[model samples]
Target: MKIAIIGAGGVGGYFGAKLVKAGHDVHFIARGEHLKAIQNNGLVVKSILGDFRVANLRATEKITEIDQPDLIILGVKAWQIKEIREDIRKVLHKDTVILPLQNGVLAADELSEKIDKRNVLGGLCRIISKIESPGVIHHIGVTPTIVFGELDKSITERISGIDRIFKSAGIESTISEDIEADVWRKFILICVSGLLAVSETTYGELRETKETRQLMIGLLNEIFLLSKKAGVKIESDFVGKAVAFIDTFPPSSTSSLTRDVWDQKPSEIEYQNGSVVKMGEKHGIETPINKFVYSCILPRELKARGLR
Candidate 1:
């Protein structure tokens, strides 16, 4: 497959390296020091599964420099999806597939708005990884996983082919029966991310503190209600499953959203918590807890974007 990875940070860098190692023609679109390091010395991936390096990488900062790709793994944040629409349109072929691996639930729909919906696939990834440095990707935890399917959840030739490619690279892969529902399932896990950013409670602290736990419940409940309003058909036990999964994390574990906010970097706040607020208004649902979280994070996010 001719693959172009849009944001070659942790997610793109790690997965793109695996594809390259599997002998796929892959190009990385990155910027600044990361681009320099990969071009000069290749990309290194440190993983518990196994560590490997890809020397003589095919890399460039512009998508236009890439040949028309068979597949483009959209690894940038949900918020940055809009920023890359024109670049993607310029290089896309009719048969080119776009898989969005953002954490948020709205990436597929958002991407399809700019491109043809037939070319967009509903996708999400499960992995804990980051750019350890300019040239290095460190896989910290989780079995790196990719769950994806057509928006309508039908099995097709390209879906199977993509599945084969991922498994060939030793990634845990699944083709969803109801990708919309699965996307919302993954979204439930993100509730704590922005909540922790606002509440500033450790996982242990959140579990022990009654007030914090109440706020967490409020956050999850709002999403569940909104999911129903949006007609996404999320499971009845959504909140319970979300809380159970959250409880399994270590005390010090914090989401990328919380960390990004603390680090004063632009984050997925608008698409994460802020999306809940926006969608609630769209669906005529009330989301006070989500609203509060989004409002609190907006000032910092604006400052980070230099919009404040």
Candidate 2:
């Protein structure tokens, strides 16, 4: 398969490197020092499962330079989907499948709005990894796994083919009956842990405090309500299930949002918590907790991007 990875960060770099090593044709669309590093040395993945490299890769900042791809995996920040869709569309053929592993529920919908819906797939990734340095990605925790399916949740040949491609690369994957709910399941985990962790200091801090724990639950409940109103097929008692899931994380651990807020880098706040808030208003549901979290973090996020 000819694959194009847009944003060779942790998720893209790790998956793309593995695919390239599996002998599939992989081109990475990257920029700056990271692109130079991949061009000169290779894309290095220091994974807990294993370590490998893909050297002398076909990487470029321009999309038109590459051939038509069979699949395009989007690993950019959630806020970037709209901005990058046009460039991505330029490289698409009739059969190109766009898989967005962004940390949000609206990724497929957002892409479907701009690009052809036939080319879009609902997807989510479960991986705790990041670009540790130029050309280097570190997979620290959680075995990397990808879960994806069609918007209508059909088990088509394309889904089977993609699953086989992932399996061939030794990557774990699942074809979900409802990819949107799967996306929301991951979103709940992030928003609750992420918002509370950002509001407090650490997972330890929130876990230790009953008040903060309740706050996290409050935020999650609002998300649950919004999910139901939006017609997502999530369980009614998901808040309880999500709390148990959050407990599995290490106490000292923080979410990508918490780290981004601390580092003052751009984050997926607008896509995750902010999306909940907007959806809440649209559905006439109260989301005080999400609103509070979004209000507290928006300033820093804007400043980080120089929008302030």
Candidate 3:
């Protein structure tokens, strides 16, 4: 299959490298030094699973240079969705399928509204990865599953074909019958964890402290209730499982938001915790913990943008 990975950052770089290693026709769309490094030396992925290189892979900064791909992995940050959507539309034909691996629940819906719903797939990634440097991606966790499926829960031929490609490439993927629930399940943990970790400045700190850990559980409970009200039936022990997972992480481990805040880079807080806050208001649900977390980061976000 001719595959194109938009935003060759951590998620894209890691997954695309795997597919290319399996001898698939993969092209990466990137920019700046990352693009330069891939062009000069190929994309480097350093992981505990294994370290490998894709030397002959095709990469470009412009979308016009590539042909319509069988699959497009939308791995850009949530904030870049609008600009990337416009660029992606230029190369997408009727048969091209878009798999948005961004965080939160709105990405697929927003993209589907712009593109055809039949061509958009809802996906959620479970991995702890980041770009350590130009041309290099670092995988920090063991969970590497990418769950996705059709928005309407149909078992179509395209879903099977994509699943086959992912499996052949050594990726741990599942084609969910109800991808919406899958997306919300991940969101329940990510939104709460991202908020708490960013507010505390470190995941380890939050995990180690009894008070903070209890607060984390509380925030998660609120998110769970909100999800139920939204008509998504999550697993019964979802919060317990999520808490257990967080406890296993390194004490000093921080979320992508904390890293972005420290580096003064743009963040997805507006869509992460901020999204929860908005949902809470809409549903008449009181999300004090989430609200406080969002308030704590709002100033830092504004300062990063020079609005202070």
Candidate 4:
């Protein structure tokens, strides 16, 4: 398959490396020093599962330079989706599939608005990874996994074929019968990202303290109520499971959102917890915890963009 991986960050770089290693024709769309490093040194991924490199890779900053891609995986943030979709459209064919392995729930919707909805898939990824340096990706922890499916929750030939493509690369992939529920399940896990950023708390800090743990639960409960009101199906008892999952994390583990805020880089503050708050307002639900978290980060987020 001829694949295009946009945004060669942690998520994109790691997954694209896997595809290229599997002997697929992959085009990496990236910019800055990262793109230069890849063009010179190839793409390197250090995974707990295994480490590998794709030498002499096909990489370009211009998406138009690549020929038609059978599949396009968006590894960019949700906020950058609209901006990148124009370039993505230039290289897509009629049956080209677009998968967004972003942090928030809204990436697919954002892409579908400008690009063809028929080509966009509801997708999310579970991976603890980061760009260790230019052209080098580090999968520090977690069993990297990809979950995706059609928006309408129907299983089809294309879904199975896409699942096969990822699995063939030794990626743990799933085709969900309830992709909505699956997406929300991951959202439940990510709700702690804002709290961790604001408090600079680690997983050990949040899980070990009764008060902090309960506060984390409160933020999650607000999201649960909002999801229920919005008519998105999530496992009824998933909250308890989510809390347990956090307990399993390493003591110093933090989220991508927390790291971005700490680095004063642009983050998904508006798309993650902020998305929950917006959905709450739309459904006449009071998301006090999420609202508080969103408000706490708004100043920093605004300042990050020079909006202050």
Go through the candidates in order and give each one's C-alpha lDDT.
Answer: 0.87, 0.86, 0.84, 0.88
CA lDDT of 305 in candidate 2? Answer: 92
Candidate 4 TM-score, true structure as reference: 0.97
lDDT of 2 by residue, 84-109 (tens): 88888887899999999999887888
> Lowest lDDT 10-mer window, candidate 3?
192-201
What's the alpha carbon RMSD for model 2? 1.7
Q: Put down candidate 4 lDDT per residue, 28-143, tens digits, no spaces.
A: 99999999999999988998888888899989998888788989998887789878888888888999999998877888888887888999899999987888899999887788
Instruction: Judging by lDDT, tell me the better candidate of 1 and 2.
Output: 1
Model 3 TM-score? 0.96
lDDT of 1 by residue, 1-308 (tens): 78899999889999999999888889999999999999999999998778999989989998888878999998888888988887898898899999999987889888888899999999888877888899999887667889999998799999999999989987789998899988887786786788888778767688679998899888889988999989998879878988887777666667677878988999998888888889999999999998998999999999999998
Model 2 error, position 240 (Å): 2.4
Clashes of 2: 0
TM-score of each: 0.94, 0.94, 0.96, 0.97
* Residue 14 miss distance in model 2 (angstroms): 1.4
Q: By TM-score, is 1 or 3 better?
A: 3
lDDT of candidate 3 over 13-49, digit per residue (tens):
8999899989999999999999999999898888877
Off by over 4 Å in 2: none
* Highest lDDT scorer: 4
